[model samples]
Target: MSKNLSALSFRKGVEKNVFERMVDAADKAGTAEKNDIVHQMGQDHLFGDAITLGAVSFYDFLKKENEGKKVFLCNGSACLCAGTQDKLHHTLESHFKKEEIGHICCLGRCHEGGAFQYQGKNYSGQSDAAVADLVKTGKGDSEDRYAVVSHLQPAILTAEFPGIDAYYEPFKKLIANGDRDALGADLKDSGLRGRGGAGFPLHFKWASCRAASGPVKYIVCNADEGDPGAYIDKYLMEKQPHSVLLGMMVAGWYAGAETGILYIRAEYPDSITIVNEAIEDLRSAGLLGNDILGTGFNFMLKTIKGAGAYICGEETALLASIEGQRPEVRTRPPFPTIEGLFRKPTIVNNVETLANIRAILTLGGKGYAKIGTPQSTGPKLVSLDSWFVKPGIYEVAMGTPLQTIIDLAGGFKTKVKALQIGGPLGGIVPMSHVGKLTMDFESFKYGGFMKGHAGIVSIPESMPMIEYIQHLFQFTADESCGKCFPCRLGSTRGKELIAKARTDSGFKIDRELITDLLDTMEQTSLCALGGGVPLPIKNALQHFGEELKGYFAD
Candidate 1:
């Protein structure tokens, strides 16, 4: 390939502005060498100086010496549990260079034990031999077990997902009109809430960023789904990426912003490639870039892969990550709506939040509003884990009874002691109380649980509650950004106390002391990692107090 073609292909792999600068620097300096170009970027502060040289040198090596296609193996917790990471690493090393095969955090296919991305396609296998075959000849299962059961939902996500145009035709016409307030108002009427655990009104964020005084604005999709059981973002990004891209475009129009970023976790290498391809498709369709839909609304979307930080799932921390800073949560009040993404007004929505925008545009906010209950309107994507017979992503209406939803997954063959609704930080409900719950925002919250990611995980009766609580604290401690003492220290201390109680039979957990610690974390924590970490601990004490008697010293 010619130098221009090579550069163009490389540009397609990254942000447009970044690519333009790299190419410009190369041309102006009269050198196409990788080292010189990287030096220019560092000197110009385009790329951070700390790691630019190593990164650029590696890029140069990949461009010049790499002969085979890139294959990314999933080293996520799920994959690790299945022993895919170690097996696949040794297998790949046998035939391919270490640089040729890379590791991604998760592909969101936790159900599919061993997962890998080869040449932009995702495949899954359960053994080393299977993964090796996947990389060598592309022979692996691509089955993503998912179904949308919402009424006239226009296929939010599915395995046989048609492109965005087939699902939502009127969206193009709506965007051509370029009426920002109308678009924002439509979303407001849709009664859509953010799906990334917060459940905040999506339109409010859009309106705030639109009204914020700033010449430069940004729209970010937080695809950093760090929640333990939540793979809804991964499912959508890999299966129906165009939905997310179109959603971001709709958000850009509503917020009057030209640039958008999809901050996906590096754990999902397949999602990264799929979303980037979706961006290229949008540009090809002339739906992105300057003069979108002939409405003179210029918007461009880029994908930034995260370095597997759970804290980065928080919007403020996500913004910090995008800016090449430590992924730490920022204080609110000067929220992202007011100041974010390089001190500019920014709106950050999760993947599912952005995916809903197209539906709102096509069905009209009121029309879409009729699908679910008044409080939590619109369909929700719930990820059922391996505990269910038919485990996969299921899209259901908000007010569906919890039992009814569970039944759809073929119910449980054995006794389920408790159901962990939402993610790790979400509340735990005893099996007896499950029927009283409804799969909606208000119902979950009323039952001492939040519909965080709507990812339901079942706990078998054999699993002890004490161990579960310990595991939850361990997750929080590891993931907590350590920004606040309450979260960082409290989670660690809680985990240690639980461990001591488990190991040393004489070591008693002081209920009053634990309660005080939980209270402190709930009140003093800077963000959700700390504020919400107390939910499961408190819920366990309230419901499973009897089983936890051994941990409390008499």
Candidate 2:
């Protein structure tokens, strides 16, 4: 968050909700959509989730009651492309009557790395100095205005973006105070769906866990945002640790979960530190572990780091990883709800999904539901990235038109040949049909994509589309757990076929060989990875037949 412009225009939905006292979104992130993007510009880790949430709670805590305080709330997920940060400072100072404390920078690129201090401690996988800071030590000197908050994460904060303001604050208080009906009703009314890929209805999951016949029910924040190009979970854990803790606490209270576990990647060093600190903070404040906010209901949480496998992102595999086993995926005959971790009835939600719980409890579910389309009723964190016109996190409404996002990104940097919907495993949307697309689950199916992690990849003219597809296939092949036949062998075969098609001096282009390999992987792969792996390659080849002719000419 580094830019020194006079002011910045409202990004899309900001103007509409400006009047609302408590804004769910931060300066950079919009309505909460999980756009899968791995930021290469910033040397951050825990993947990316650590950045988003780290920025959130710090900002929320810094400027909650005192709107008169002009603090620069720079979200970690959004780095300064131009003058965005400076413009934000101007807006906060002029509009909110808050003291314009210096910018709360994240991503360490705050006006040419201005946010970092030589004395700062560099967390292994986190930005050098992304967390909020009020480092100016003084004896209550009123002249020192800038708080210097670091690493305000957008990932956790956006969970409540769907609801209006402190709609969640009240539910959080109620849950802390032991009001189950209010907690349940608010979460339900918030229409807060889980941010996990499964997208299960949050209220339904909570209710199911709450009503389970078992003596004990469990709530799990699937902090393993392991989808390729996703870091929202890590960001939340590191930045807004309490938001996630509070979410789990509220979920534990609502779903009757005696305990909860945050299954995150051990690789995310920043997340571990921040999460541990937040846990300690709440424990000291007596709002975590047990008797939160003086409620009779008791709850506890633990952070289990994952071994870092894509499939582990699947709830079953994640449960296995947390239990200290190999991170292999398990089937869904009895979904996590019935036979989850330790074969107990468990509810697993991604970090962004669970982040909404505290807010939903504070705000009525109805308020939350009003944020997005009827079907998808919550703000989502989309980690937007890659060779796009604009590269930043976008929080668009669930059903927002894809064109709006494309346009929002200032259009493609190069000629837009194909818009790859979803992630590497997701299919390609040829240049022809992208116009009709919308950014929700419903429209994703038409393009033969499932909106996995809301990953939108832009294909420029310079991209060797066929080679890119093959690269994805190769990555999938390498990552395969070797559990199932289709995924294990099929991905291998598919990658081979792509290689053959790309550079095989083979006298003949065995189209059937490639087609059959794709077919087998699609039909037999264990999870979406191996199964979905063949899609981009096959779809690209199918859609760009003319382009493939060059390779087959041998």
Off by over 4 Å in 2: 1-172, 176-190, 507-509, 552-554
For residues 122-147, could you state the per-residue lDDT of candidate 2 as single tens digits? 11111212222222321121110111
Give lDDT per model, in order: 0.72, 0.54
TM-score leader: 1
**Across residues 101-147, which tens digit of lDDT does each residue of candidate 1 receive?**
76554466655456666664566654666666665776676656654
Query: In candidate 1, which residue ranges exceed 4 Å CA deviation?
Result: 1-107, 112-125, 128-168
TM-score for each prediction? 0.81, 0.67
> How displaced is residue 95 in candidate 2, in Å?
50
Poorest stretch of ten by lDDT in candidate 1: 55-64
lDDT of 2 at 29: 36
